[model samples]
Target: MLDIKLIRENSEIVRDSLRKRGDDEKIQMLEELVGKDQQWRQSLDKANALKAERNKIAKQIAEVKKVGGDASEQIKRSAEIPKEIARLDDETIALKTRVDEILMRLPNILHESVPVGADDSANVEVKKWGKPKEFNFELKSHGELAESLGLADFDRATKVAGAGFNYLKGDLALLDLALMNYAINCMVNKGYTLIEPPFMMRRSAYEGVTDLADFENVMYKIEDEDLYLIATSEHPMAAMFMDEIIDEDKLPLKYVGFSTCFRREIGAHGVDTKGLFRMHQFNKVEQFIFCQPEDSWKYHEELQANTEAMFQALGLPYHVVNVCTGDIGNLAAKKYDIEVWFPRQGKYGEVTSCSNCTDYQARRLNIRTGKHGGDKKSVPHTLNNTAIATSRAMVAILENYQNADGTVTVPEVLRQYMGGKEKLGKV
Candidate 1:
């Protein structure tokens, strides 16, 4: 959410930022908020004036009574003032609430460095790592290779659960665990504390981290509970410090969260539905950082670099793209997406995303840091990036490391985690 003070003082600046988002409705809502804010200020001023008048009249009544003069007129005037003040108070409160709701709906201001574009097509590739390996033979998709090897069973999973779910048998399950452990260790070595948060969260807490529309499309709500299964570890980790004020000395708090993410994956019917690429439930290692506002952009790069290093160690060819403003979404001021080359698809697919929200979420969550003593507080910047999503990484590994003989070579860095196994073949 934007600071109301910013919207009030620099509305043109805010409007220009909203225009960049390509959201017409939100721009109109912002205009409405401005009018409502003006009315709220007027109402509050009137209420204050009435209260002041009441206080003055009460003093007059006391003075007139002390001198044995008629004080009934002063008393009646004071009584009438309270009723008017009450009505104005109610009006101000309603207007203020509406203004706050609109502010929360508004997207964050984009950083100047972010690419101005209508969509991902305008995103610029900033860096590329490793080259796609040339294959003499035709490559099969990860789904076909995994099913043939008995590593993943989609038919049985569909029977037990539904479409978009899979059961990993034997080595494939172990590989998932190994990938998670490898990513977790890599982040921990980089000085990030690992946290395992609850898999479910309440609606109130989740609202603090995301837009209202996500509640229906992205999240899975429990049948009879206030909890909804988490879509990413980032959600829980970001909400942990809701309404909190940290010390300034702890300017940068880094965390590596591991969790089983659940998503409805609604509207994704036939796209990568049978593969590990797009599943309803998957394990992921995510990186989250809370730092001073001025340092978030720097930390954003650091987070992206951390994800790239993990990909490099796994020997996956990938490239980093500076996400365009229209594709950046509501939470992040700027974003970078790392798209890994999928040999079978003959193109790059998004594997990890890094974003710097830059106090956008902190303002909504009321996460702040004390400036000095306990007197003043300021919102801290929040960022999150994918360290490794096991499902997609597995897809990359299955396709990129596949041999002509139908064996998949494990990345050297993850071999130790795989019990010294060098290759995965038909068991």
Candidate 2:
């Protein structure tokens, strides 16, 4: 939630920020909350005054009783005061709940530089890499290519555990592992600490880490349990320090989390259902950071560069798209997605997303700090970048490196990781 103090003091400024996100309804709600707050405060003031009068009259009654006079009138007056104060207190509590509820539902205001638009179609392209390779013969989708190379088993995977699951055997499994290690190494070299966060996260903890809507759309809630299968290492890895204050000297703590993430794949009925591109489970090396608000944007660029470097090394053609304000989603203030070109699909597919969420996520999680604990307190900014998503990367690797004779040539950089093999052709 955004700072209520800021909202109350500079509501128009906040409105303008939200306008960039095209959230007019939320802005209206803020105005109504302010009115409720004023009414609640006035009632509280009246209730407090009545209580003060009651206390003063009680003291006089004690003096009168000591002098052997009637104290019945004073007692009756005090009784009314207690009832009045209690009623006002109840109203105040209810009003506070309403205020907090609105605050929680309001999405983060967009950063000034975020392009204003409705959807991905309006997302601006930041940069483009190598062109999609031209093929002399027919190009096969990742599913066909992997099957031919004895890499993936989709039918068996579905038999074992419903749809949108996969079994990456042989070189494909090795490739997934290699991608995870490769991404982690790159992030660590760029000053990120590597972590293997727990695979399962409780609903309470997960809620602090992501938006409420994600519970239905993206997460897998454990039946009859309070836990939810984590959709990304980002969830537990980022929530580790929830409701905690960090030392100023420890500013900009960065972590690269590697884990197999699980999602429900809800509403993805007939979308990307063929291969590993969209799956119930996939490996990911995620980059998460806690930084001073001022440093988050700079770190955002650095994170993008790390992902870009990895894509370039993999010998894949790709482009960077600056996620527009509305399309940037609720968490991130500004975002960039690295979309890799798939020769078979003949379209760019997202392989990485780098976002600077500013202080939005931190404030919700109550992750805050001050300079030396005595300085100005503020919510630390949080940022997450997809260092590598193995599912999507496989699409690029299989399609880009496919040989004319049904072989997949491993990128030169990954050869060392593959025991110095020049190519992943038929053994």
Best by lDDT: 1
Q: Residue 387 lDDT in model 2? A: 90
Report the error of model 1 at residue 404, Å: 1.3
Displacement of residue 168 (Cα, Å) in model 2 is 1.2
Candidate with best TM-score: 1
lDDT, residue 188, candidate 2: 86
lDDT at 426 for candidate 2?
44
TM, every model: 0.94, 0.90
- 395 in model 1: Cα distance from truth in Å? 0.5
Q: What is the C-alpha RMSD of each candidate to the true structure, in Å?
A: 2.5, 3.2
Q: How far is candidate 2 from the true structure (C-alpha RMSD, Å)?
A: 3.2
- Regions more than 4 Å wrong, model 2: 44-80, 266-273, 371-375, 425-427
* Residues 261-289 of candidate 2: C-alpha lDDT, one tens digit per residue: 89876334332337887888889999998
